[model samples]
Target: MAIAAASTSSFPHLNHTLFPKCPSLSHHYHFRPLRVPFTVRASSAVVLERDSITQPQVTSKVELFACPVCFEPLIRKGPPGFNLPAIYRSGFKCATCNKTYSSKNIYLDLTITAGTKDYTESQPARTELFRSPLVSFLYERGWRQNFNRSGFPGPDEEFNMAQEFFKPSEGGVLVDVSCGSGLFSRKFAKSGTYSKVVALDFSENMLRQCYDFIKNDDTILATNLALVRADVSRLPFASGSIDAVHAGAALHCWPSPSNAIAEINRILRSGGVFVGTTFLRVSSTTPEILRPFIRQRVSQSYSYFTQEEIEDLCSTCGLINYTSKVQQSFIMFTAQKP
Candidate 1:
């Protein structure tokens, strides 16, 4: 839940405290459920790793853990006791802000549970919680601005990779699949590269976010855009209708990615483009070591794509021009339907 702006000065101290509490670090659970109150609004918010399957919000067993806001570390001791394993619950002294809340005391629930169908279904709930309040609050407070402001860092790199493999404008209809808040979609719309930028996603909240951002920006509005609410697995478009398809940080959440590719191929025109970027697999064989990042997302979960897998999927989808690269912890794969 902490952003990059949060200080990490106390990281060393925090690590010291954590190791002492759990001496058998390897055996200790990598993550425990915590209800993080992200906004000033008093509501339980979920906080988890960005790469694991276990979510913190949906679980019944919530524990207690407090991370210092200033240093973004769990306070080991505070106030009168600099060395005590304690938290300054009341308030904290800040050099710049007179006495401020240096810590946010929250829960770290560790309830026992089984991974059944019911347990797995909890993923959607976690995704919703993140998309609704977490992402919304981040957007409203300008957290997302930092993500895109510095010139859409990831997209340019991705597009550059695609360009190396194919011409910049094999232009026709482009579909920005799983376009969160429409940053990539707007980028394409503003690029003046395609005739239509079909901004699509399963989450209405996310699609709406993209819709609002695009409609307000004259550059994006200038280019034709159509928002479609449809799951990727069962795309509503006719076969071979789309010219290019690109999805940024959003393949893992599809539930059935292979089927989604089938649909993507179904809609993309012959000799069209299909581009994707995903996280490298975080180790599916060992869940215990990395099972607590929480929530299914394009960055985590089924998010990462292996090179062989990418080529295989492209080959299966009838895409001929297969090109891929690993950049900034992402597998950028570009293929063309021929």
Candidate 2:
């Protein structure tokens, strides 16, 4: 039988007796199976080599999270699963850039500037307002209820409408962008409509509030729900990897709606759905004389868009089949990735 070429470097743990120093014999010479002792040694060496070859496969599962810097799929190490507990225990690292990400508090921080001590940056006032502990604490209490004045159909109705729009994306990954205090993210997880629901926000206090709400509910806590801290304009996921995106009462608060929508388009796969609700600059029934004044006042604080502008922005971002339901200053829009 022909002997396989084996290098000492390849099998450093093997005994040197396996390869006898015989100057007369070539390295590629055929070997005859003579002794049982030699066969046992060769067998053990082969077993070791096989184990070495297959060792990397043990931790080869790619995670849904990607490196914010390079956007490469992260390799997960630790307990496996998509639940909050498992993700919290696990550590993620990008093979391409070798950057590591882990749960800092109760949530995984995937923001571009996650770990800089001296380079902290402040966002616009609209975006930074939610980051305050006081605002985060009051978000679900009474602040959110104030949206009724703007004609936002209550959260229950809004959730139902969003669920209706999200039917096609059932049993897939759904990301709740700008999920302040996880009002709708908790509902999405409890509904069991998606295989995984990511409650993502840029505010640290908001994620803490989300975890606070989730910790008490075993049903939602045991589900495939994850709280992620990330910027909407620079979402931390692989391109074309997400199935659905929801932004509720969040468009006006983004620093740049166009950039945020474009990032949403980049993350969604073909046929994926995007649903969002926001305050419009002016409703169709608004008096023409008061329209400019309302626009000017709202523009100074938040970037509110009209119905036509919302549709135009969606189309310009490469999303198609745009549709909306407008009620006074509130508009809920849906679009699809082509």
Estimate the TM-score of every prediction: 0.52, 0.81
Candidate number achieving the greatest lDDT relative to the actual structure: 2
What are the Cα lDDT values of the candidates? 0.49, 0.79
lDDT of candidate model 1 versus the reference: 0.49
Model 2's lDDT to the true fold?
Answer: 0.79
TM-score (C-alpha, index-matched) for candidate 2: 0.81
Q: What tens-digit string does per-residue lDDT give for candidate 2 at 79-156?
A: 445777656644555556756666766688899887677998999999999999999999999999999988989999
Per-prediction count of colliding residue pairs? 8, 0
Task: Give the top-scoring candidate (TM-score).
Answer: 2
Cα lDDT, model 1, residue 286:
29
